[model samples]
Target: MADKSNAESIITETQKRISNAFDVFDHESNKTVDVREIGTIIRSLGCFPSEAELHDIIAELEDEEPTGFVRYEKFLPTMTKILLERKFRPITEDLLLQAFEVLDQQKKGHLEPEELTKYLTQEGEPFTQEEIDEMLSAAVDPDKNVILYKDFVSMMTFDDTR
Candidate 1:
């Protein structure tokens, strides 16, 4: 049987792999990541945790503030749940790369609402035009079609009703 130290080491190594997977999906090239981006990353990994799954994970994550935004300290365990829920089995780096290519539709290193909606709909989880409009409203300036990385990250990080 594995010793306690060995088990801890294994856990650390698994977390490392999960973190690397997240790095691949952090399209803004920023260290700070967001949950919608996380959802895309999870889908890329061949898993689709429902909204309920994400809510439960977020609820359990330490450092959730009264306002409900997770602090950087809580981000790792929260992301770990998305990246390594099915055990420490190795996830392919190629898959991560492919997922990035898919998500980076504009090749701008940030996600646009239209891009996200199209991708989700392609996967059979459609987002209505109104939902797309609302999501875009959060990130885009009125009459603007482009989304800055900072705004995009903020929108992706925050949980929304739509």
Candidate 2:
């Protein structure tokens, strides 16, 4: 129940922020924001993507409209992705810690290999056994057969090459 309420509040707040951004950037009142406006929006959100990166982002939106603009509805997903990836790193790390705490039932600050597998497959957002095995192989300490809280958080927050 509490989790549900928190999720709802997050969604509501995200919608409010997006709406506010749309209002600020949609200069022509055409319900779409131009590429120039997008650059301003991205900067306002505190992400300073390089000129090439910004050009690439704008290029991706070219197909969305003939005028090379993105409608507010269409822009929300991109905005959300950027905010999550850049502005919310600390929040992401904190969420990972909370999840680790749930699995560390005895407050031992680490999980036995088997406990890690069980938690991954049975609890929230179940992953396949193969996925769990791969994750363990990548980050688990072989001699101890346990994954420390720090290692687990590091693994979760790792930036994939892709």
The parts of candidate 2 lying over 4 Å away from their true place are 64-66, 87-162
Error of 2 at 53 (Å): 2.1
TM-score per candidate, chains pooled: 0.39, 0.47
lDDT (10s digit) by residue, model 2, range 1-162: 999999778766766777787789788888788767887776655555765777877776666445868777667777777765554222356778888898787999888878888777787778877878788887678788788877768765635221
TM-score computed on alpha carbons, candidate 2 = 0.47
Q: Model 1 residue 135 lDDT?
A: 68
Top candidate by lDDT: 2
CA lDDT of every candidate:
0.57, 0.72
lDDT for 145 (candidate 2): 74
- What TM value does model 1 have? 0.39
Q: Model 1: per-residue lDDT, tens digit, 1-162?
A: 469889788678757765676677666766555655655554544455666775666566534354433344466666555444563233344554456466776677566656666675676657677767786677665556655545455444422211
Candidate 2 clashing pairs? none
Residue 131, candidate 2: Cα error in Å is 47
